[model samples]
Target: MLTINCPWCGPRDETEFGFGGEAHRTRPADPSALSDAEWAEFLFMRTNPKGLHRERWVHSHGCRRWFNVERHTVTNEITRVYQMGSASEAAETAPAAEQAPATAAIEKQGSRS
Candidate 1:
């Protein structure tokens, strides 16, 4: 099982959390202006990239707070964890050397598997 580091509650078993889907999606400025296809795309479309992916997650069994996670899809390695609304585009594109300490810990865990 994976150990997820909750920004509010520290590291916890993955079972304590709930997946909240892809993050950083902006709501349309005027929903009424959207055609049916556009509205459906907004609601259902998500990127299924093979490498790094940003996602939302909630600590359901602990603090019940929401956070964002940057994870590697194929390896299941969580590279970063940040509170909701605090992530910046620059941080998202930062180099590995500048990655958070939590990322190192998660990488270590991934290596064990």
Candidate 2:
């Protein structure tokens, strides 16, 4: 019953979207050069962190566009939503204090609902 705000289509029901797994995963430049174990790791290995997690989500029932969502794993609070290939990726490595603005925005949005 979460409300996900699509970067292009605004807020919509979570049911309208499809989870696209962990975000920011870089595929190998030459897949054929990888060993079996290396390829397997690339396909199956993903971080399962307990706190903030970056993920990809597609608005399947709406615009059908994909975007990134920074969510809290335990609380399911979505802290930020941005279009693919944006500069927001830099925020991933930013200090926690630098991320306060995004978190505040989410908190404000939640208060409205």
Candidate 3:
């Protein structure tokens, strides 16, 4: 049983979260520009780093926000977690899973009251 620590919602069962592959990786803006191999690489290849790897995780049950997480691949231990930001953030830097869009939406709703 894998458990993930959601920065906003605390630690929860792994079933509540979705593994989003490597963090800081984005789909090509123009798929047409990519060659067959490049497209395949994007879709299939991934760097399963042994240590201090960044990954994306979605909190399906709690905040419903897609965020990033820092984990150890070999040991299956999570070191850090934060929220995924805008598209640009995904490109430049993969922020942790504390500030996802869903949480932002929830925060907005709370502010309205």
lDDT of every model, 2 decimals: 0.74, 0.74, 0.68
- Which digits, one per residue and each the tens of the lDDT, describe model 3 over residues 1-113? 77776656767899998877887767899999999999999989988766888778898988787767777878888766655665565444334433443233221111211
How do the residues 18-62 of candidate 1 rate in per-residue lDDT, one tens digit apiece?
999998888999999999999999999989899999888999998
Each candidate's number of clashing pairs is 0, 0, 7
Can you list the residue pairs that collide in candidate 1?
none
RMSD of each: 7.7, 8.5, 8.8
**Predicted candidate 2 versus true structure: per-residue lDDT over 2-106, tens digit per residue:** 898776566789999999999888899998999999999999999989999889999999878777888999999988885566345534433542443443333
Top candidate by TM-score: 1
Residue-level lDDT for 105 in candidate 2: 31
TM-score list, all predictions: 0.74, 0.74, 0.67
- The TM-score obtained by model 2 is 0.74
Error of 3 at 92 (Å): 18
Return model 2's CA RMSD, one decimal. 8.5
**Which residue pairs does candidate 3 place in steric collision?**
81-97, 82-96, 82-97, 82-98, 83-96, 83-97, 83-98
Q: Put the candidates in TM-score order, highest first.
A: 1, 2, 3
